[model samples]
Target: MAQFYSAKRRVTTRQIITVTVNDLDPFGQGVARHNGKALFIAGALPGEQAEVTVTEDKRNFAQAVVKRRLSDSSERVAPRCRHFGVCGGCQQQHASVELQQQAKSRALARMMGTRDAPREVDEIIADNPWGYRRRARLSLNFHLKSQTLQMGFRKASDKELVNIHQCPVLAPQLEALLEPLRQCLSELKAVRRLGHVELVLADSGPLMVLRHLSPLENGDRQKLEQFSQTTGVALFLAPDSETLEAPGNVAPWYHSDGLRLSFSPRDFIQVNDAVNQQMVARAIDWLDIQPTDRVLDLFCGMGNFTLPLAKRAASVVGVEGVAALVAKGEYNARHNSLKNVTFFHENLEEDVTRHPWAALGFDKILLDPARAGAPGVMQHVINLAPQRVVYVSCNPTTLARDSEALLSAGYQIRRLAMLDMFPHTGHLESMALFERI
Candidate 1:
């Protein structure tokens, strides 16, 4: 039995009520209004009637879990993964693909509001339904009393860990190595000191980075080497903040397009390679850059888009806050012989209106910002009114907020599409094309 961390409160069981789900909340939970108060129920699809047991009651709304389905929606499908409810990794595995896409479109539309919403929504880009995840961070916990290693995602609404034997979303190689890894860890004395395991599947093979709090003994090192030899997965050790070392002949993971991009186990890279390829192609296609066009690529990391855009544009300026990434981007540009691209390291969050580039006219602009969105960059965008702007966002709410700002700045949304970069989840990747009115 798993031990769950719970908040202190009085436990009261309310009467089981049958409610018809009317819509979905932002997190994809089915929403139903009961007696003028909103009820957010998990495992209940929109348009379906279900008996729910209220788990949490709040001032404005209540949360419940489906006790029994009275009427099922056609959109509800049998979830493929057995760990769907226990693991917090996937939220919409029970929803049909069509229904999931519709829900995402509706969510995006609601965020953008009716005035400046996309006139037509494109079909959500779906990839492999299973075994598509190429990167994952699995939390590690050792129960000394049970003498067992616990590895997997955290439980929903709780801090308890779910010891998953096999994950449907992980690549087959990584999935097959899970049990062996657990067994290996069980034998190691340093298992108690292990905090987490970061798994990265490159084009070549899978690599395991063990995050440990203490140094491993020689016997533990031998065990790791034996496991790596048997499983053919490279083993890396992150013993402390300053040290990261690989035991055997493990090469660095390099993701390449026109130029090779190298990063340590810690650097950020899109997990899904196939979808990332499509996303990059889509962003470039939407930009519709010309040879004479001058472009500005904001929040550029290692020249993912900057180098590609440099191939078409007259000159592309890439700005990134991290000096290391900016240096890497410059090296990649030079390695690819992309002479038209220039990298600048600056804090984009600060005002750049007084910068020299603020006066340098740019015909096209492309922004791929983090989840916080690009409010600071938006001001610069308003100052430097580019003829065409392509915005790629991982968060819908921030995208909507920035879209509203751009709309007020006399930019009309020309095209918008959602890419299902992450499947079986509520996360959305959206791209919008804005042209100056």
Candidate 2:
């Protein structure tokens, strides 16, 4: 039997007790177990001693805030970003880049267990430590008393907005337009109706997408257009799903890898351009496609990887759930003059065995499924029996679950590497190569 503490009872009060951090949790918070109960201490690094004040006490674990750093880890460093704590965007900014990679790698290794894991872990794929984000979602809040437009990310664990003047993680061009955007929004009468603003950077320029709950008047539209023309930022309005319109001469712009990949503002694309390029290169390298090899890409979006794979393989088939994206993907393939690639629209959530494309044999397979993972597509991989499988994942838990399924299907994980795609934050991107046993 275990003893329990009551919520009304104060277990510890301002007790300046020194504790050593055991490790960091998924959220980059330091983890330490005290009296068989876990304590998640913020601003503390692993292998370091810190004085902490308990913020919230729970039956199983407690949460605390660090008061003083008695001893610091070698990996501890001053954060580079000004809005590091207030923005809640980057959690590992205080930790060294090398230590951050090590933490991510250790997390992946633990998730995949050591029973039959690979002996050699691939080198970490690094990206620009700052100003690499190509897309961002900025919240919009208007204060009735102050008559000011508060635009930025929400503070951690609160609805209060941070109101950032500049973001180091965003593209330089987009970051430079933050104050201009705030000024433009502040001048509009319909600014109160705008709830959020999303920025996506294409090769041509930055696109500013505004999410407004109410219809904009003519004057408000003119304000947006003037801002767009003055700052050279494209403006997009989103009052509803059916009401996605661009005002003025603003046209859709896209970022590509020498291959056309036009997408709507709502579509999902990798946020870090440099890291994505490296990740794509790594995925292609792991494929090791022979000139005669046929490749099949699952959950392919906008032919990001499909068109690239087509260049190396004899034929490539891409499957996606969104029909619009499939059409764009096919158009991209055609524009790139890659006749070897074909895009199909199918609901991968349902059974894909009956699909006509499933009958086609493939030599190599690549999967970049969403956070839910490819649970419905795993059995199909067994049925297709591709010689090699390359999987890129964003969720480690789901990746581990899917990896176990692949292992049961006689696929052995050969190599794996972590890409610090979202550096500063706890989000991790990983790539794994599995060979048919």
Candidate 3:
């Protein structure tokens, strides 16, 4: 189907339009208007005048990026990362951390409130702003024209590869391998057959998973092992038939709140260690589990909170949509020797009220759904009659939508806090506690 667009007038591409940024959107884009239609300009801050080029013209709105800044905002700060504008890994780096937190805090408050006046906000939970990311996915751009492999990140605006020498956001040990991996890949004849690579800094050490379309020769395998031995990066190659190429290794585990969690190489884990720790601590405290309580955890990945809740509650049942995560959750429970905790495989988005697991009454419930939010199951939450519910969210817009559903079902928000998980990015992580009226 062809796309229909709304515009004040037909505008040609690459047309330069001077506009004053009125405010910032959740994506860090500057919001403005031209001829009554909304225009989004990237890299332009509020209270600044910028000359932007129209990149995409759409119905009701258009996308653009600032070509030149004519005026500056008082909150703008120098970005710490040299590749800030190009790498696309980090956004809102030019703004002060204080302003970024304030923006996110107010956004959440506005979503939670009945009026425009800023809702009363508790202090934000924060940690070190830099070197917080523990896991990174680097791209493999095999250029046939130049016969070179660009092992780095893509540009913020497009799929064009931007070769990185170092990334300031990644942990120190992982950042040091940026150039080394590039050099190592350059010598491989199978470089073009390589897929994207995932580099992770686990509590045990650094691990690398290389997805390959073709097999690596014996010589190449030896070279990779040597690279691993020299750099101490546990390298595993997928799609290889032999276990020798990809070591059959146990899941890497991280300890938090007296519980040990083991996750697969590809399993999701919080990238910011410090903030994740605090987030877990807050969840456990807010839930106020009791020895006679049976708690239900929705979207519980790898038992991050299930095991901790198990220590206080009579029993904790963790439900995950992904079998891999459920398996890891079971493994983590065994690794931690928590007999009161159990994991079940079920899609949280589907109706599961009849599932035998749901037959058990839950005194309190905790939800840590993905960015899409857990709207499908929210309408049925009242059936369980949980006394309290703690919601952990990554997206504010979705959280607001779900909160309304819970409110209509007789739940009142008791406590809320904004977690500064990604300090320099235009991302928001919030935790709220709601009680049945």
The most accurate candidate by lDDT is 2
Better of 1 and 2 by TM-score: 2
lDDT of 2 by residue, 311-426 (tens): 88999999999988898888778767899998899999998988889999999999999889999989889888999999999987788899888899899988888888888788
User: RMSD of candidate 2 to the true fold?
Assistant: 4.0
CA lDDT of each prediction against the hidden true structure: 0.83, 0.85, 0.84
lDDT tens string, model 1, 1-437?
A: 99776777546667688899998764669999986899999878899999899888888999999999999898889888888988999898888877777778777766666666544555465677678788899999987778788999999869999988888888787788888888998899888889998888876578999988887899999999899898888888888865789778566555555556655666677877777777777778888989999999999977778888898899999998888789888877777788998888888899887777667889999999999999998977977889889998999889988988899999988888877777778788788889999
Residues 1-437 of candidate 3: C-alpha lDDT, one tens digit per residue = 89687687677658899999887765577789986888988788789998999888888899888889999999899988888899878888887777778777877788877675645557699998888889999989788899888888888879888878888778888988888887887788788898778888888788888877887888877777788788888887876533323453535667788676677677789999889999988988888888999999999988888888988999999999989889888887887788998899998888898788888889999999999999977866678889999999998778888988888988888888998988777788898898999
lDDT: worst 10-residue window of model 1: 117-126
* TM agreement with the true structure for every prediction: 0.91, 0.92, 0.90
TM-score-best of 2 and 3? 2
Regions more than 4 Å wrong, model 1: 1-15, 57-60, 115-119, 249-251, 254-259, 354-358
Per-residue error (Å), model 2, residue 197 = 1.2
Q: What CA RMSD would candidate 1 show?
A: 4.7
* Candidate 1 lDDT score relative to the true structure: 0.83
Pairs of residues clashing in candidate 2: none
